[model samples]
Target: MIRTKSFLSLLLLTALLSLQLTTRAEDGYRLWQRYDQLPSKNHLKQYRQSLGEVMVQGSSPTLTVVKEELQTALGGLLGQPVTITENSRKKEILVAGTPASSALIKGLNLEADLQKVGKEGYVLVSKKAGGKKYTVIAANTDLGVLYGSFHLLRLLQTQQDISNLQVSNSPKVQHRILNHWDNLDRTVERGYAGFSLWDWHKLPQYIDQRYLDYARANASIGINGTVLTNVNANSLVLTPDYLRKVKALADTFRPYGIRVYLTARFSSPIEIGKLKTADPLNPEVIAWWKNKVDEIYRYIPDFGGFLVKANSEGQPGPQNYNRSHADGANLLAQALAPKGGIVMWRAFVYDNNVPEDRAKQAYTEFKPLDGTFKQNVMVQVKNGAIDFQPREPFHPLFGAMPKTPLMMEFQITQEYLGQGTNLAYLAPMFKETLAADTYANGKGSTVAKVIDGSLHNYSLTGMAGVSNIGNDRNWTSHPFGQANWYAFGRLAWDHSLTSEEIAEEWIKMTFSHDPGFVAQVKNMMMGSRETVVNYMTPLGLHHIMGWDHHYGPGPWIKDKPRADWTSVYYHRATEKGIGFDRTKTGSNALAQYAPDIQAQWGNPATCPEEFLLWFHHLPWDYKTKSGRTLWNELCYRYSGGVDSVRAMQKTWNTQQGKVDKERFKQVQMLLTMQEQDAKMWRDACLLYFQTFSKRPIPQELEKPANTLEYYMSLDPKFVPGI
Candidate 1:
């Protein structure tokens, strides 16, 4: 009998090992939709008791998705079958509804309040109804209920209390979206993750479970919308066949409060519509857009809006017709307004006709047309005036436009900040911009306040992040990159969340709830962004990337198609000195801000050290707080960034067994890559700058082991996204 028992145990062990191996082989493409069984814990038992049964009050493809998602997640967490019953019991019952479906919900004052909430807004409450204890998730529409269901599941999965829950949260902005710069051919522009998630050829018919999982993850974090195609707009996504495919994704995402948005090809009237011109003001062009909007609405009634990138990077727009950006935006806004959609016109534009100071161009163009834009139009501005750098001051446009609603555009993809190789947590980056005091109206005019439309009484407001998501096992190629997407959604919903809080929450959800592990990882995540900025573009240095790929270092790049496109334009690293001169002596761009801000930033001595080089030109011998000259300070920052990554490696190494083996190993390998990359950045930058400063390597710092020529020769062909 003992021999037989031992053989049975060995057989069971072998079976478990095989299952584990199979699971590990699968990349984390499912993201948080991993419906793996939760550990047997006291919290799981309590949650299961509170959520004994579910009652769904809607029927659609989206509704089916919600029910299946809830069933899968609940089954995994509870380790038991959760029956769905129509009748309410004295015990706890999960109730989901649209305002039209639930009479009890319709009777509540919530119905009037629900009108204020968008179709995607939802409320979760634990209350006694009809003499029975219930956890009810009600929304203005079925999509809202689907979102509520995900919210409830997230709280439960993250080990938050579900009993007596009274959560009524709606997105402050109408369109909280993810802009995927994914090409139809599967190359993602500035995307660090593997390949594009949307396989265009297989899309409409072969609805991958990954699509449903993507919706679940986004809805869990309060993301209400998604823009599927690249902002460098493609005409094909507008075709009837692609629209059908998009409708498939829209159907999958609808119940989860996510509406599918498309990157509008302004020249679609010419390219796709075969018109003579794509002028927004032309009667034919206007009619074409109206018909297109009608076509989209017919397929997906909850279609969010259009994300337009025009007259920037050779893309077509109203400027082609000699009309202003506001003219371009207003035309699209008019087409969509009848269907209750919005037009998010990008504010990132600059060309030879524009002024030399690229940072100030957006403000120069958009601020003048404050009230000119239609009510349904939002000017989407990058966090900084320039592209998403490692560190950037909040865009001046945030405070400048009170009448026109401006949406904050953050890049979740680490375009300039080490791509997917470096484990930089961008929660701090987002928090830095959001918490910045815009001082538009008065003392406390933070960017957050402006974005939520509280400071300005504008009706339309929002936030969008260019997605880093891809066909990776963990969704984001780098595990830490997931935090950026999570942080964007959290901040979009409630811009009040601190970086520390966000890091802690993400660490707990993504890794472990163990306080020791959370604390250690959170510390690394919290400081990671600053470290990258220090190493790469410290003290307001910007846009010094390789010529084409924008990877590693290319501070020596001077000859490109456009002078400004090259790194040399911004760095100004000649024999005399380095750093852009945007002061009274140069572009005088500082004058655009309020006099108080200009006064503060105008002078190098008084200017915040963070933006010192951004505004003022100073001698290399300029004194800093560290008692080192400007040159010395630059070296120290670069060196510090390198050291910080090494320290992060040590911190992560200590977390070996605390996290899942596969994830821990993956992070360890990435950290090794980051350390190597950080060193390369430090060496290449210092070597290049040495030509300008004519200064020896500081005594305390290690000299570059090789020549600048050697560093330059180590060029990587086929740099990921490039």
Candidate 2:
């Protein structure tokens, strides 16, 4: 009797502790939509009064979700159950819907407003009608109403005054999407967080709640499309069995206005259809693709389309038969066009075998084929000429491909920027690329204008982010990585939003609305990308990371299979100088850009110091704009990066009690790791580069803890995201 009584007590105690831990822990699964409660009771009272009764005025799948989301969010935020009300003529009722669904919304005459914001946009206003004031969320479509609901919730979450709300908004770009690099085997390529989110074997039968939550989070941020597979795709996904599974996901996400896309393997005809050649010009190949697409549409009526990676990185392409990238892309485009689907053909191709600079290859291949692509095809270009580096000049393809709709492909994954462990907020990096002056048509031709279809007047426009999401409980491994994902969606919707503004908004919604916490965290996030660059690859240094894993500094890396894959090809850090020469005297990569830019950047003296070593090979003793020798500036930048990280640690440590203990401690520990890593990057790169520069470390900077030989000898195994 005593033993049984003791067991029962222990069980009861365990359950209570579990409940408390769950309730108290902020694991970041909710992402930026963490709507726990208003910080101030007076603020909560005002919100409750403004949102007296909630009414999403429709019965469609999308509006139903809108209702449920509002109910849950409002209930948690207000500390009471949301009341929709039984009264027919209630005043101050928060209503949301399209004009066709509600007579009250129709009577408000929102035609002009609705037309201005477009089909996917909404008008949120507070109006007086029939001696009653009502806060209305009106749009022309149910999806728009859903978007408005999220925006209103954001206002509430951030504790803004919504009593006199008048907001009109729309996504700047069409087809705002996420490109997951997840493969069929449940392993994500360059996925630092965990396994793939899609459980292929169990997917069609059992729908994970994570799928629903994922769609909800994306819908809240106006991301409408998701390419489900890796760009280096497998043909098995095109099989009938997998199509059924994809259909299940499509059905689940349809309610939240998120369409599903898949990456089409170029050799599907050869692999899946048993054809001899996967040539784009082959009739059998063409017919096979058409039939496969037809079958996919039967399963998923609203399939977005395909993202293709061909003729790059050993991927099969039409080039096997001497056809251009356009031919390979058009093969898929022809099949998708009739169904109102589009092809996002990637422009990340490079024939590294060519005796030319890698940065110039993509432009040479795609520039001449600008007007040749099918109208339904969008040429997806990376932000930088090289891979997702810490910083690089904007791709020459952006403004150059005016006749074709160029889609911006930004990496939200931190593959090149410390992966999952480091706290590197990427909004500043994204904004830097977006704000680059392309000088395509004139001085005002920014990359943002070219992408949103304002520069060249292309009919179709899109922006794709390489998703950092994984099956981790936090979605993204690092808690702050969620901020990068949030920033990508926010900027994809509106490029005009400043990075600082996005950081502030994310901080307020995700962590705390307290002025000091938000301000301090925002400041830290705003400078994080620069700090990482300063430490890792400052002043035009590029692609010097460790071989295969790219985890640590590998400035001595050479003799890789391809010359471009080696650090030696980019930096060219000889005994006399350090930096690549891409000027007229060297590879002439500058010729790909506009004449104005070429004239400015081609000359080493005129180039911005940030890109000084990128375009010009300078001697170690060359005087920088700051009057320091090139070697000293490089040393200072590396040390400054380490110092900035320590400052961020100090900033984060002061907020221990301001947020949840779980997330606070999580960030604190991660910051410590970051500080240590920053030191490693500084020491390794400076020590190795010093061997060539033959310069002493500055008096103020800390000396490296180990010799260059010791640093070179150390090779970390089991690096994630290889």
Candidate 3:
């Protein structure tokens, strides 16, 4: 009896401790939604005085999100109770709206101009109204008001002065989506975070607070769309049972202006509708898709349309029906057109039968069908021609597809780059790809302009990132991974925002507002992506991760089914030299680029060192402008990456007291892990590549402690998304 009582006491204590630790994990699943206490007491007090009472004059599902979010965020930041009053005659009040719902806003002459701002745009102004000075956040619709509410809170959270603020904001791109490669069974493809947040089994019955929180987080960043299932799809999602579950999530996210998208299995007509041939040109197949889409829209009126992965990597597509990609994409676009939906057709296609370079496949496949796609169809191209490698030249399709709308697809999940274990800030990489000159129209044709439709004059434009989100307490598995999510949103909303600005904003919102802390952390964040690229894929080397798992080095990967699929095919390092030659003399892939870019990159001496190995195959003895031979420069770059990571570690250590203990420690541990992995990458790559160079390691750098073979053998078998 005595022992039983002691055991019960111990169990209770353990549960309480677990709960406390969970509350303090600082893992980042809450993302920017942390709503942490404001660092400036004066600013906090000032904001509280001006925005203490949130007078929500309207009630809608979206307004509910706004009110609840305001109350929760304000209470956390102010450390005081905040009330949502029905009456707004009080001195200090926050009036939010649509004119129909908010009389005070209507009286302010906002309704006349609200129509111009549209449903998702907002106008926030500080003015004198009805004998009292008040801050007003108004919009044409409740969704816009909700967005405005979050925008106002964001400014306050970052400790910015709102005394004379007059801000009008709308997304540059209409669709900002996070593509979840989640299976119905809750397994996420290439996901390093926890299990899928969409608990399909329990959802549509029990609406988890996690779902609400997910909507809030996405809304805060202006990510207005989410595709909840894997692009490598299953047809069952079109069934009535799954449609009910999808509607529940759509209803929850509606107020936040987030629409749910689903992956449409091309073979669904055959599988679910009992049709023999699921051909895009087939009248029966086309008719079946129309009916299915009609059913989906009936359930989810604001349903974001289908994302299709056809005839690629074993999934069924247009090729099975002897139809072009346009045929497959347009059929669905036609179906969803009446409902005002759009089709996002994936351009990630390759086949074992095609003996051409894997990097050339996507460009070849989509180049011919440039103007063939319907107006509502967007051809989604991966950031690189190949899969999401650590470093890849911007896809050739970015420049080649001038007549069609092409959406940029970036992977935020770190599938090939270190997953959740390695600390890699991806903003620099994103900026690099976006800023690359595609040179389609002229010298200034950049990938950013292409996706934003400035270069091609496309009406339908978007940017999609494969999400890293899951059920982890911090959202993304690694704490720093949140920065990628934040960066993607900032870039998606305004591609013009620099990486430095994005990093600083994220640092202030996620960590500390102290000037020194922000400055120091921003430097680390800016350099982190390049550091990973250098250690992992320096000098334009690409796709060398272990087969399947893709965790660590696999420079020796060969003997795969397809020659192009092997890592050895890309690097092409032998006794003579390295790099795949894509120049006019070689594959003539250089012809795809505008002549000016071709002139700059075609010549080895003038080509940027960052992409030298991508376009040119230089001899080991070739002298670089750095006064180092090609081989020595490669070794130096690999070592430099490791050194940069160490510098990031030192900088983070100095920031210990400035950030919360739990979060600081979490980042420190991740950085420490990064150091070890960076070294592993530096050593293994140099040692393996050195065998072909037959050169000595730079004397100043430390040599690998282990043999090349030993490093190859010491593999972590548990790497996810293999």
Candidate whose TM-score is highest:
2
- Give the whole-model CA lDDT for all candidates, comma-separated: 0.83, 0.91, 0.86
Backbone clashes under 3 angstroms, per model: 4, 0, 6
Please write out the lDDT profile of model 2 over residues 1-722, one tens digit for every residue: 99999999999999989667544767889998876777688889887876768866668899888888888898888877887642346666888888898888898888988999998999999988888888888998999999999999988888788888889999999999999999999888889889999999997999999999999999988899999999999999999999999999999999999999999989999998999999999999999999999999999999999999999999998888999999998989999988999999999988767888999989999999989999999999999999999999999998998899999999999998989989999988989999999999999899999999999998999999999999999999999999999999999999999998888889988888889999899999988999999999999999999999888788889998899899988999988998999999999999999999999999888999899999999999999999999999999999999999999999999997788888999899999989888888999999999889889999988888888898888799988666
Better of 1 and 3 by lDDT: 3
- Estimate TM-scores for all models: 0.93, 0.96, 0.94
Highest-scoring model, lDDT: 2
lDDT of 2 at 344: 96
How good is model 3 by TM-score? Answer: 0.94
- Which portions of model 2 show Cα errors greater than 4 Å? 1-23, 85-87
Candidate 3 ranges beyond 4 A from true positions: 1-27, 110-116
Worst 10 residues of 2 by lDDT: 83-92
Error of 1 at 30 (Å): 3.4
User: Which digits, one per residue and each the tens of the lDDT, describe model 3 over residues 69-89?
Assistant: 889998888778889876866
**lDDT tens digits, residue span 1-722, model 1:** 99999999999999999667534533445555455555548777777776778877667666676678778788877878877655555466787777687665664446655666667778887777566777788888777777778778777756787777877767766668899999999999887778999988897888888887787788878888899999999998898988998999998776676788999988998998999998878999999989998999998897888999989979998889999998888888898998889989999988855647888888888888999999999999999988898888788898899899989999999999899888888888888899888778888888988898989987988899999998877788898888888888888887887888877777766666677898888999988988898888888898987877888888888877777787888888766677888878998888777777888888888888889888867788889778999999999999999999999999999997676677888888999998888888899999999888999878989777789998888778888876
